[model samples]
Structures are given as structure tokens and as C-alpha cells.
Target chain A: MTEASVRRVESLGASELLALYEQMCLIRRTEQAAHDLFMSGMVKGTTHLAAGHEAIAVGASAALRPDDYVFATYRGHHHAIARGATPEECLAELMSKATGLCRGKGGSMHLTKASTGMLGSYAIVGSHLPMATGAAWSARLRKTEQVAVAFFGDGATNIGAFHEALNLAAVWRLPVLFVCENNFYMEYTPIAEVTAVPNPAADRAAAHGLPGIVIDGNDVAEVHDTVARAAAQARSGDGPTVIEARTYRHFGHSRTDPAKYRPADEVERWMARDPLSVARQRLESLGVSADELQQADAHAAGVVEAAVDAAKNAPEADPAEAFTDVWADGGSTWRT
Target chain B: MADVITYRDAVADGIAREMRRDPSVVCIGEDIGAAGGVFKTTVGLLDEFGPERVRDTPISEQAIVGAAMGAAMTGVRPIAEIMFSDFLACCWDYLANEIPKVRYMTGGQVTVPLVIRTANGGGLGFGAQHSQAVENWAFAVPGLKIAAPSTPADVVGLMAAAVRSDDPVVFFEHKGLFASKGEPAPPDHVLEFGQAGIVREGTDVTVVALASTVATALAAADRLAEKDISAEVIDLRCLIPLDVRTVLTSLERTSRLVVVEENPYQGGWGGTLVSIVADEGFDLLDAPVKRIAGACVPLPFADALEDRVIPTADAIVDQIRTLVAY
Candidate 1:
């Protein structure tokens, strides 16, 4: 491995490190199970999994306070899991159960838990960035120290909302962290083909007059440390920060995509550096026993399985729920 | 005591009253701060509330509306201005998809108490880019509420209602009506949605209008009276929660309908009103509903051509005469 791939361990305790490992493992196992369920025709609609991008979600979420808000993209199961959404709720949403996060109104692409500060996951690319910035603006106006983190892919950086939100956040000096998960591909097209700049964080941040940092997203510790620092700066009223986390997605853009556009060698190269494995190996090198790591893995697997089983048994949402929640006044005449 | 105030001042007064009543209320838009907005509707707001509440945003409509959505979700009532209704095309996704869908999509986890105020209607000679009325675009969104106030009193009353609504509201202020003077609205007056204002009472033909066309309909009513044909005029204050009851009541009296609007006839809010009347009050109609609307074309810059494209008082009079004869 190159020297850049070797991430230095931070000041986290053994238990904290184990917890991070468990979170990442839980996300992976849950996503894998969700993919299997989709393939078996049990789960309806579509799902965008974050198999390889677990570290960014886990680490960034680990750095945020319980009340800090997180806005994520369609590839957001990991984000929901890391932000304290139980696998049951996440899978229940995918399973279209009434007990789901959005009460099954929002399927896989719109899992949200306001209690955990996991704002709704957006299916439209780069659409939620402004909302995140607006949340930060609200926090500032309310004299609260809450910070909002917007998680999007590399492709979102090219969208107009992305540029507008960044510029507004900077001008208003709102407490927001713009996290870009650079997985190299925006849907099927490679980022290099669409993006005008080499580093999105650097290019976009310069234009908006905000601090930009490109870090190793595969390194959970690095992501945690960088996000922790940025979140601190935001809470202290230093304005927003743009963080470009360089990572990869192990799965296709969606369930049906075989990712035939990607070369076999490139996929193999990234798979070899899987974030979970890298973290596991680092934990082992730090004197963690293999049995302890195995126990964590088993725990994660059990949790995911239990969630799937529970989701399968959860009651279907009432059809009348479609008419509700459309308006606050309870006067929506929309017939189901 | 009611004072004579311009529609622009009425809108500003309504915003100031709301801001004073609620500390969480804020205004964000381009040139709304030190420059007092391109239309000067937001003048003296920066001085009253300071910059923290009155923000001067960059020319970013998507971010402006999106940020307002976020703020509204988090307990702040944001009044964002798009300068011109035509510019809503620039941020259609946020206004159409994100802003309107959030409350419903989140299953009522959040409420977007946002009021997007934009200047609409033609006759200003700003051409297609700045003069086109796009209230129909907002009317099409189910979750969105639309308010188009014609007189100064209605402007303040509707603005208050919009700021106080839990749902997202799109307030279309006609640029032509901004300079027009009317009696000031009562203090703390808040008009409810789906309430129609009867500007003129008649029994020959009922004329439905909104925004700038309300005045035209009234003028046409006066001309129709000279011809011994009295026309009843109804100003539809809000479009989404349409006041069909009032229109139906007028239809029962008049037995004839003529819908007038500044927007094009195809897919216009006037068509929706006509549809409602047709679907519900078909027995009351003495004749088929006639629509007097702008021509289906981009508004041109030239004065004579622009005059032909938009509906005039004469056009409303002619439509009313035809319906009355029928």
C-alpha cells in the first residue's frame, strides 16, 4: 500500500474505535441484505446502496452531535444508520411498512428521522444542498449552535444548486458543512468526463470563499477528525466548510445497473481497498484481537438479519395515509 | 381610520407588521437590503429589522427558495422574493419539486411556512423576460397555495395571511398594480385563503378576474352598464383554495360567466375557475363560459403588439356583451 493509504490512528479509545467498526459493519451488512431483498423482488421501487462509502457516513456522523442535522443523497442507508436510525426502521421503509421512518410514504430514496436529525434523503441530485444551507441559516437566526451537513456525490458539485448554496452559505457565514463523496462516477459517467476541475472541493470552495479540504474518505479516522474539526468551526460561528471525501461505491448506481460502464480492473483495484477491510486491518494492527473483530462482525450481521425479519412482518401502511400529511390544515382534497 | 397607500407600501407594511409580530420572520432576496429591491417594495426594511433579518442574497433563486425552505422547516418564516414571476423558471425545480414536496414527502415531519413574493403581469413593457404572468405554473402544484392581490388592501391582507400560513404560499404581485393607490387595510387584518372579494355587484353577467385584470373587469362593468348590461365582478384573491362558493353564488344571480386573466388562455388559472363553474354550477349558467385572456405567445417589447397580446378593458367588455347576448 502507498504511504497515503496508511492512515495514522487518532486519540480514540478502543471502545470508540470498536463502535466505529460496528457502525461501518452494520451499514455494509444492512446494505448487502437490502440489495438481496431487492433482487428477490421483495422490496419495491429502487435503492442506491453505499457499500464502499460506509466510512464517510460513519465518520462524519460520529463527529456530529446528536442534534446536528444531516441531509443525504439517494445512496443514504449508511447515512441513516450512522445517524442512529435502527436497521429495522431503514429496512421497514424499504419494505414499505407503515412503521417506517416516513411511514412508507417515502420509500428507499426518502428515509428520514427528525429525532435523530437525519433529514430526508433526496433522490434528485444536488437538490437538498440549499435546504441544508437554509437549515444552517435558521440555526444562526435562532442563535443556536446547530450545524447542518449536506452529503452528496461528486456529480452534484456540477449542479447549479450546489454552486448557489455554497456561495450563499459563505456570504451569510452559515454553519453548514458541504460533504462531497467523490466516488469517481456520477451515475454511469465518470467524474473526470463531466467535472471541469481536478478537485471539486478546491475548485468550488475557491469560488465561494470557503475553506476546502480533500481527505481520504476510506480512512474512517481521517474523515472523523476532519469532519470533527469542520463541525467545530461551524458551531463556533466560523461559517461553512467544503469537504471532498475521496471514496468509491462498491455497487452499481442502483439495483439494475451492472456498472458495465466501469472497467473490471478499476473495480478490482477499488474493491481491494475496501473501507471496511482497511479499518479492520488497522484495528488488528492496533492490537485488537481477531475474535473481538469477529464478534463485532457477527453482531452487525445479526442486527441486519433481525431488521430484515422484522421489516417482513411489519404491517403495511394504511391507504388513507396518502391523503394525510399533504397539508397542515387537514383540508387536502387529494383523493387516494 | 384607513389611509390611502400604494400597493407597494401596503405590501411593505404587511411585511413589517408580520416581522414586528414575529421575531422569526425574515426577508431574503436580491437587492432587497440596502438597495431596497429592484421594485423598491422592500425599501426601509433593512433599516427597520437590520441586516440579520433582511438579507441581500446573490442572484440565486434556487438557493433563495431552497434556503427559505430549510429555514421554514427549522422554525423561521422566510419571505423570499424572486423579483419577477418570470424568473421562477430559473428555480422551477426547487419551487415545483423540493419546496412543495418537502412537507408532504416528509409525512408532516416539517412545515415550510414560506412566502415567495414575485412581481407578475405585463403592461410594464418589460417584454417576455420580465413581464409574463406565471401564476398558472404555481397553481398547477397541489401542495402550493397561490395569492394574487389586485388592490392595496388585498395586498396587505393577503401578505399577512401568506406569512402566517403553515403551508408554502406563492404571492404574485402585479407590477402594474404596484403604483396604484387604494385604501389601507385594517390593522392586523389577515385574509383567509379561498375568499373572493366582490368588487362590483351586478346581475347580467358574472366576470371573474385576479391581479391586474380585476381593474379591467371593473372598467368593463362600467362600460357594460352604459349598454344596459350590468356585469358582476369577482376578484379571486387566492387561486389554489379557490372560492368556488362565491363564484357559484354570483353565477346563480348573473346566470352567465366571463373569466378574465393576464396569463395566456391555455392552462391559465381562469380556465381552472371556468372548469369549476362548469363542473359544479352548470345548471346556473345561461350560456357557455367565455374567457378573455392574454394571447398564447411570448409578450413582445413593442407597445402596439404588447397591447394586442394582453387582454384589455375593451376585450372584457366585448366578452361580457357576447355572454350577456347569449
Candidate 2:
């Protein structure tokens, strides 16, 4: 890690700093286990791992209170865990266990817990941008102090809903934080090949008359400070902010593909800048040791093991539940 | 207790009564305030409730619907207007994705008490751009509740019911029904969602209709009575939560059926009704189901051509005559 980033995380208290490192580790370990299970056919459906993009979700989510709403994309286990979803619940969802957050109905693509104010994890590209803006606008109308955050990939910035949502949020000065996780590749297509502009998608925010902040996605302290200030500004009714975190994906877009689209040297370089290792070194420099880190790891691993066991023992989803939730009253005139 | 009231006036009364009853209800749309609605359905509302409650928004359909969704989720019941039902294509994302799916995706933690009021169908030569009966599109969305009322009373009653519901509702008002006359419905009338009113009863044939087609269906029933065919006409006032029992009862008596609609013939509400009857009451049918609906082509600007596309009383009678023989 760089000297500057090291000093930045060292500024936080021992407990908070230790918790942040452990949280990122939990995300990495849980997702790594999920990747192994998926490859071994222990799980079903498409799984998108957030291996290299941990710092963005962990850092940004640490900025807000529990009342704040967060919208996430399909690659969302990290975002969910960062927003307070337990590692076990998220891991169980990937495994399609009954005790998953959505009772296994949402699986990897859609994990939501509204009680925590985590609005949803949408499967559609860029669809949740407008939804987040709507919720932020609602918060402003109702005079709530809570702000809404929308997290998406760099590819989503090209969709029509993204532009429409950002412009509307700017025009109304809605309390929203638009975070773009620019992981270099948008499902095998390089950012340079698709976007004519720079890598960080935050550059486009200026056109909407909003401030855009670009930070080192791998640096947790920089992401936290940048997002914390932006989130504070939104809660105080100072309009929205666009943050682009430049990062890389450790794995391919899904369970398949060996990331042949990327060069061997590029992967080695990002792996050298691993977020967990960077945070651990910062904590150690601040006098937290390998023994303390091991304790946190044990705690997280225990939590995940308990959660997976509980999920496996949970009851199966009722067949009638498929018909439920479609309507508020459990009735549709079309079905007669 | 009654006077000459246009369908527009009935709608205005509906909105005014809801706003008076609940402080949470408000109106938002283009030209809905001081200028009133495009058809003046919201005239004098801003003066009575003030601009904060009766809002006029930009022509952007996406912004209008999005603002309504935002307002609805935050304890405000907003009655948003799309100016024309045809304009809904511009904001299908807000309609189909964000609004209806909000409560469900959130696992019922929230409720969207919203109403989208728009005029559909063509008769005054607005042509294709301003005219299209796209209620089927709203019906296709799972979380949305839809209704198309044919009478002044039904429109007023259904509007009140829509604003009172906890779910999002799309109220499709036919442009052609604005001037059509009917007995004045109750000023404070409340209409149930899944109930269909049998306007006229006969035994020879059953014709199911909704919205503007209800009037045409009644007229066709009168003509069929003259010819001794005795056609029974059922007005499916509510489109989405269809009153299947009423339709089944009509089918039981008539033993023959025809569906008349203003929407496109292919994959229309007619097909939906046919499938329901075919699955539930196959033995009751004496003839192949006949569907009289709008032609697949867009509504033409020419008056005669427009007339040729929409379902008319003559068209309904022709289909009923063919069904009766079988």
C-alpha cells in the first residue's frame, strides 16, 4: 500500500478500523467459497462475484446511517454485506438455502432487506438509478433526513435511465449519492472500447451541474472519506454527488470465463493492491497485529458457518409464495 | 339531486371529493392546475386546493410519473395525468418497473397509493399520435390495477375507488365517452374493483364489453331485441380484476358469447376473456367465441377511416348475429 493511504486508515479508531478490515475479508472469503461451490455444482444459476471491488462498497456504505437507502446491481454480495446484511445470509442466498434474505427466491441477483433500509439489488442494468432517485425525492418530499445511494457498474452509465435519473436528481436537488464502480471491464468489453471519455464515469456528472468525485477504489480510507462527505452533503439537502471508484475485477463477469479478456500482467498488478491486505497492513502499522486479525477472521468464519447451517435447515419456500408479492392484496383481475 | 353533467365534470367531482376527504391526496400533471386539465377535468381544483396540492408539471412524461411515484411512496397519494394514454410509452420504465414493483420487491414494506388518469381511444380526429386504447399494456403489468368506465357514474365511482386503494392504479378514460350521456351517478358513489354491472339482460346471446364499448354494446342489444335475438350485454366496468362470476352467469344463461373491445384484436382483452371462459365454462359455450375489436392498424385521421377501425354497434350486432346462429 502507498504511504498516504496507510496513514489515512490509521487515523480511524482501533475498533472501527479493525471492523472495516474484517468486513472486507468476510466478503472476500464468503465470495471465494461461493465461487468454489458454484464451480463444483453445489449451487445453481448465474453468480457474479465482487472479489476485486470490495473497497468501494465497504468504504462507501460505512459513510451512512442504517436509515439511509441503498440500491445495488447484480454483483451485489459485497454491497449487501457492507449495507449490514450478514455474511451468512448473503452466502446462504448464493447457495440457494432456505434461510437466505429473500428465502432463496432472490438468489444472487436480488438480495434485499427493507428493515435495514437496503432497498433492493436489481438485476436489470441501470434500472435502479431512477428508483433510487425516486426514493430520494420521496425522502425530500416527506422531509426525512435519510439519503439514498445508488451503486452500479461503469457499463450502466451508458444506459438511458442513468442519464435521465441523474438529470432529474440534479434538477430537483434530490438527496442521492450515485456511486459508479469502474472495474475496467464491463463484462469482457473494456471501458476504453465502449466509452470515448475517461475511465472514471464521474466525469459526466458535471454536465448535470453536480460535483463528481474520483477516488482510488482499492484505497478504503479514500473511498470512505470521499463518500462520507458526499453522503453528509446529501443528508443536509445539498443535492446529489457522483463518485467513480476506479478498481478491477479479480474474476470474470460470472462463474464461467477465466478472464481471458484481461492480460496476465494486469491481474498480477491489481492482486498486488488487494484491498484486504492494504487495510490489514494499515491496521498493523497502527499497532493492531496478526493475532488480532486472526481473531476477527475466526469470528467472521463462525458467523458464516452458523448462517449456512441455519439456512440449510430452514423450511422450503411455499409453492404458493410464487403467486404472492405480485399484488398487495393477493388478487389480480387478470387471473380469473 | 341531478343535473346535466358531462363525463369531464364527473371526473372533476371525483378528484375534488377525494381531496376533500383526505389531505394526503393531490393532483400532478401538465395543464392540470390554473389551466385545468387538457380536457378541463381538473378545472377550479388549484383555486380550491392551492398549487401545493394541485400541481402543474412539465410536459416530460418520465418526470411527471417519476415525481408521482416519489410522492406516492412518501405518504402522499398523487393522481398523475399522462395528458394522453399514448404518451405513456415515454415513461414505461416509471410505470412498469419502479411504481408497480416497488411494494412487491420491498416485500410489502411500502404501499404505492397512486392513480394515473389518462384519456384513450380516438374519435375526434386526434389521429394515431394522440389516440390509442393501450389499457392492455397496463393490464400486462402485474402490480397495477386498471379500470375503464363507460358511464359518468362509473367513471366518478371508479376514480374515487382508485385514489383510495393502497396499490398503484391506471384509470383509462375514453376520449369518446367524454360527451356520451348517461344517468347521473351518485356524487359520492363507491365502485368495487371486481364487480361487473349487467346493463341489459337477455337470453339468446351474451356480449361482454368495457369502457366506451359498453354504450355501443347496449345499443347493439337494443337492435338485437328488435330482431328477437335477445342478446344479454355485460359491461365489465373494471378491466383488471374482472368479475368472472358475472361473466360466467351471463354465459350460463346465453350459451353464446362475443367480446367487443376498442383495443387491437390480436392479443387484446377479448382474447383474455375467451381464455377464461374456455377454461372455466367450456361446456356452457354453444358457439365459437366471436371478437369484435379495433383493427390492428393505427386510428386513421380521416373521420370515416377512424369509424371503420373502432368497434361500433353495428359491428357488435354483426358478431352477435353470427354467434346466435351457432
Query: Which candidate has the top score in lDDT?
Result: 1
Task: Give the per-residue lDDT of model 1 (tens digit) for B180-217.
Answer: 99999988899988788899999998898999999989
Give per-model TM-scores: 0.97, 0.91
Q: Each model's interface RMSD (Å)?
A: 2.6, 2.9
- Best candidate, TM-score: 1
lDDT of 2 by residue, B226-301 (tens): 8998988888887777778888888899899888988899768778788889999899988888889889998899
Give the per-residue lDDT digits (tens) of candidate 1, residues A1-336: 123433454856667878899999999999999999999998898999999999999999999999888999889999989998899998888888887888888888988877788888888889899999999999999988999999999999989999999999998888999999999998999998987888765467978899888888897888898899889999998989898888988889998788999999998988888988888877887889999999999999999999999999999976887888877775575211
A39-134 in candidate 2: lDDT tens per residue? 877668888999988888888878788888888988998888988888767766667665677665677888776777776787778877876886
Candidate 2: where is the Cα deviation over 4 Å? A1-11, A330-336, B26-35, B45-75, B94-111, B181-188
The TM-score of candidate 2 is: 0.91
Q: Return the lDDT, model 1, position A12.
A: 66
Candidate 1, residue A173: the lDDT equals 88
